[model samples]
Target: MGEPDVAANFFAKPQHLVKVNRRRRMNIWRSGQGSPTVVLAPGFMAVTADWARVQPALARTAQVVSYDHAGQGFSDPGPLPRSPARTAADLKAALVRDGIEPPYVLVGLSMGSFEVRHFAHQYPGEVVGMVLVDPSFDDMAKRLLKVTPSDQVWIESQFTHLKRCELAAKAGDLRPGTDAYAACVFQPQPDLTEALNKTYHDMSLQASYWRSLASEFSFAARDKADWPLADMPLIVLSAGDRERPPRPPEEVEAIQRVYADAHEQLAALSSRGARRVVPNSKHAIQWDRPQAVIDAVREVIAAVCGGPA
Candidate 1:
C-alpha cells in the first residue's frame, strides 16, 4: 500500500490549540465532563496520542485531558532546556487559557512524573490526586549509579546518540533508510493508526522535536531533592516487566532493587499513597496495561470525589 496523507489524517481530528503565551501555543485533546479533571502527562518525547488506549476510558467517568508538551506533537516550540518547572508552568498556563479548571487528578507517565510532581508542588491546591505510571523518580540515575555504576557507559552512549540525532535533524540529514533515522526514530507502533504513525514519523524529522527530547533527557538525569506530596491520594505504578539493558544478571538485579526502593519512596511522599507492581508491562504501562492506568485514575478520582476507591 502507498503511504497515507499524514497531514490530512492528522488534521482530521479537531485541533484545540490554546495560546499559553504570545510565543507559545499548546495542543490539547479534552473529553468527558466532571469535576476534579483527569490530566494525562506524557513521558519524554511522548505526545498526547500515546495515551490512546487509556484516556477515553478514563474520560467516561471524569473530564480527561491529554496534551503535547511544547515542541512536541502539534504544539508550538517554547523556551529551551524544557526543564520540569518550565513544562509544568506551560501546562498550567495552557490549562488556564483553555478554561480547564483545577482540582485535577494528574496522571503522569515515565518522565512526565517530574512535570506533574512539580505542578502539584507548585500549586498543591489545584491537584487533588495523582497516578504515576512507571514514573522516573528524582535523581533516579544518580541513585541507580550508586548500585550499578557500570551503566554509566550505557547512559553516556545513549546521550551521545541523542545529540547525534539532534544535529542530524538540524542538518536535515535524518531521512528514512539512513543510519541516523534508524537510531533516532522508533518504528511505527502496531497499536496506532497508519495515519498517526505517519504523523509521528513526520514530527520526528523536525529539529525542534529532537531538540526538545534532548533537552528533557539531559535535565531528567540531574539530581533533584525530593519533596512531600502532603496527604493527597497518590498511586505509584511500577512496571514489573521493565526491560534491562545489556548488563550482568547481578547488576540488573541490583538496579531493579534500587528502582523498587525509589518507587516506594515516591509512594511514601503522600499519607494516602500506595504502590503497585504492574505485571506483564514494559515502561509504557499505558500501552501494555491500559486497564491498570485506567483503574488507577478511577481510584484517584473516586478518592478525590469522596467516593469508594
Candidate 2:
C-alpha cells in the first residue's frame, strides 16, 4: 500500500517502474534501491501490501522488495495452473527487471514457499539465503491443496467472514469514537480501519479469484527438484499450533511428526539450517507473529551476511 505511492519519497526520487515485456508481464510491481535485496513471496490469496507492517522494518536492515504474484494482488492475470514453476519464473523476471542484482535472500510463505523453493533449486547462485515462514513443501502441500466438495464450505465461510470484516471497517462502524474499532484491533486479527480493511479485502478477493488458475496447473508434473536441500543458510519457521478443526489428538500428532521429519531432513542437508516455531500461531504465522518472523530473518541474514549484527 505505502510502497507503491511512497516508492518515490522513500528513495528520495521517483522510482521508475518498467513492465516486463517477457512472460507477458506475469510479474509486476518493482522499485527500490538496496543490497542483499529481499524478495518477499506472499502466501496464497495475499497481496504484497499485506507485508506493510514488516517491510519498513526490513527496509531499514536491507533493501526489502515484495511483489504481488501474477493473478493476485495488483498484478496482471497469470496463466492457468499456478504451479511453483510458473511462480518462480515470475519472481526471477521481476527481480531482474527491477535491476535487483542477485544473491537474494528469498523469503516465502505458504504457497509462495513453493515459488521460493523452486527458485532456490533452479538458481542456487542467485540465492544467498532462504527464510521459509511456515512454508508448504511441494509434495506435502499438494495433498492438502486438493480441493473436494467439502473444502468449499470452509473456503466459503472464510470468504464471508473476511468480507464482512472489510465492510464493517469501511463504514466507520468501528472507530476510535467507538469501542468496536478498539476491540477489533485488540482482537486476533490485524488492525484495519474500515477503509484499510476493504482495500486489503479487495487484494485477498482478487487473489482468490485466480484459484482456478492454480487448479488448472494442479495435476501437472513437478519441475524435477530431486532434493530441494536449500544448501544455503536457511531458517524454517513453522506454525507453532495445529489448532484447527479436524484436529483430533491423533491428527495433531501426525502433523507434528511430519513437521519434525521435515525439520530433521533439512538439518541433515545443511549445516546452517535452523528451525523455530511461531508460538500460538495458526497457519498465517507470519501475520500472527510478525516479530518472531522478523527475528528469524535477522538470524538468517546474520548467519549468511557475516559480522555481528
Candidate 3:
C-alpha cells in the first residue's frame, strides 16, 4: 500500500483535489450543476478526457464529474493490486472527502464498469442509476479464449506490450510507438486539439497507468460473482459494429454474438435495466458514438430526477 502523503503537486492543473489519505490525492473535474451527480469512469488506460464528448453533453443537464483513477492521468499512484473493491472504495472516499454527496448516477465505460458495479453493490443507496458503456463482464478473458483463440492471442499480446512499456517507463526510457498507441486507441477524434493530443500521449506513457490496467485485468475473473440488482434505472450500451482484423466471417460473428449476449446479461442486474446497441460503434462507444452514451445518461437522469419513471 502507498503511504499517506500530502497532495503537493499541481502539475496537471486539476479542477478538484481530494486527499484519500496521507499518501494519495485524487484529481477530479466537474462541470454544470444539479442533483444526483453523474460520475464518469473511463476505461482501461484511459483518463477523464476520454469522456470529452459525452461528459459535456450530460453536464448540461446535471452535475458531472470525471476523475483519474489513482496512478492514471494527474492522480497520484495508489496502493498496489488495484482490485475493483479497492477502486470502488477509493472513489467513494474521494466523493465524500470532496463533499459530493449522493445519490449519484454512476456511468462507467469498458473496464470501468467493474468498479461502478461494485460501487453500486457496496453502496446501493448512494447510486440512483448506472450507465455501463461497452462494459467488461465476468469471465471475459476465459470466454474469449474459448471462443476466439486468435483474438485472445491478440488481446494478450497487446497487454504484454503494455507491460513492456510500463517497464520501460519505469526505467526512464519510454518505449517507441507511444504516439501510435495513442492514435490507435483515440482515433476518429476529429475535434481533438493539439494540447489534448499531447496529454493523451503523456498519459499513455505513464507506467503507473499501465500497471493499474494490468492489475485490473488480472483480477477481473477473481472478482466475478453474482451482483444483486438495485432498484434503480440501469442501461447497458453495447456496440453494434465490432473491430477486428480480416478473419473468417463466422468467427467474427460468433465473437460479436458472445459480446451481445454478455451485454444483455448486464441489463438483467436491475428491474429497470435495459440494453441498447449503439449503431456503427465499436468497443469505445463514447468515442465511436458519443450521442448513444449521452442519450443513455440523459435517460437515466430523467428517470432519476422525477421526469419520468
Candidate 4:
C-alpha cells in the first residue's frame, strides 16, 4: 500500500500545523481559553489522541494544548536522534509559532516527563507548574541495573525488536498477515474510533515513525544527570498497579521497589511537590485513571494561582 491520506479521514477535529522550523511543522490541537495554558505531552510512541479522556476536562478550566511529536502522528519527520533536549526545543518552538503564550502548566505522561522537565530547565520562567503521570525518572535505568544486571539484557532485547520493526517498515514488509505487521502494529484501542486506529496503524508502517521511536528509546536508556526543580510546584503521579514484563516475580518486586522509591524522590524535587499513587491503574494512568491526572493538573494550576491546592 502507498502512504495513507492523513488529512482525508483522520482530522475530524480542528488542528493547527505550526512551523517549529523552516523545514518542519508539528501538529497541534487547542481547546478552551485562559492563562497558564496547560500543555499535554504524551508518552513514548504515544500521540495527542491518547489524551482524549483528560484534555477536555482540564480545558474546561484552563487553555489546554496537545500535539503529536514529529514523525509520530500527523507531524512531518524531524532530524535523527530524537533526544529529550531536541523534543523540548521543538515543543517550545511549536507553542511560540502557534501563539500560545506561557506561564504554563505542563503535564507529561511516562517518557514525556523527560521532555517537559527539560523544557522547564531550558525555559524556567515560562513554566508555572508541572504534573508527571507515571513518569520515567532520570537514572532509573542505572538504579534498576543495580537491582539486577538482567535489566540491561531486557533493555537490549527491546531495542532489538524495535530495530527489526524499523527494518521491516523501511522494506514495506509491515503489511497485514505478516509477522512484522502483527509485531509492529498495536491492537486497536477501545477509546479510539476505527478511523483513528487505522491512522495509528498507517503511521506505524512508516519508516520515519520507527526511526523516531528507536532514537527516543536509545536516549531514554542513557544516563542523564538530574537537574534541580528549584521549588517549582510539581506533582508526580505513580501507577499503583504496574504491569509487569516477562520476568521473575522476585526481579519484578525488586524493580517495583526501586521505582517506588524513585517516584518519591522525584516528588521531593520541589518543596511543593507531592506524590499520588493512582490505585488500580497501570503506566497509562491518563487513560486508566484520567480523573487522577485531571485533579493533579487542577491542583498544580491552583498552586500556581496562589490558591488552595
173-245: candidate 1 lDDT, tens digit per residue: 8888899889877578775677767777878888888888878988888836377888999999999999996
> On residues 242-262, what C-alpha lDDT tens digit does candidate 4 reach at each position?
999677899899988988998
Which regions of candidate 3 are displaced past 4 Å?
Answer: 1-12, 175-194
- The runs of at least 3 residues in candidate 2 whose Cα sits more than 4 Å from the true structure, single-residue gaps closed, are 1-18, 26-33, 141-208, 211-213, 216-230
> What's the distance in Å from true for residue 278, model 4?
1.2
Error of 3 at 20 (Å): 1.6
Cα error, candidate 3, residue 296 (Å): 1.2
Model 2: how far residue 73 lies from native, Å? 1.0
- Residue 81, candidate 2: how far off, in angstroms? 2.5
Report the C-alpha displacement of residue 304, candidate 2, in angstroms: 1.9
Q: Per-residue lDDT of 1-309 in model 2, one digit per residue for the tens?
A: 453322122322212333455545533334344557777887766665556556666776777777766654456666665667767777777677767788787787766666777788778778887788876554553333342234446555554554454455556455555654543332322444444455434443333433523442342213333355545788878788845556556655666767656655544455677787778887777668878777776777777778532
> Which window of 10 residues has the lowest lDDT sum in candidate 3?
1-10
The lDDT of model 4 is: 0.85
lDDT of 3 by residue, 131-183 (tens): 99988888887776677787667777777866776776676565455653543
Provide TM-scores for the models.
0.92, 0.71, 0.86, 0.92
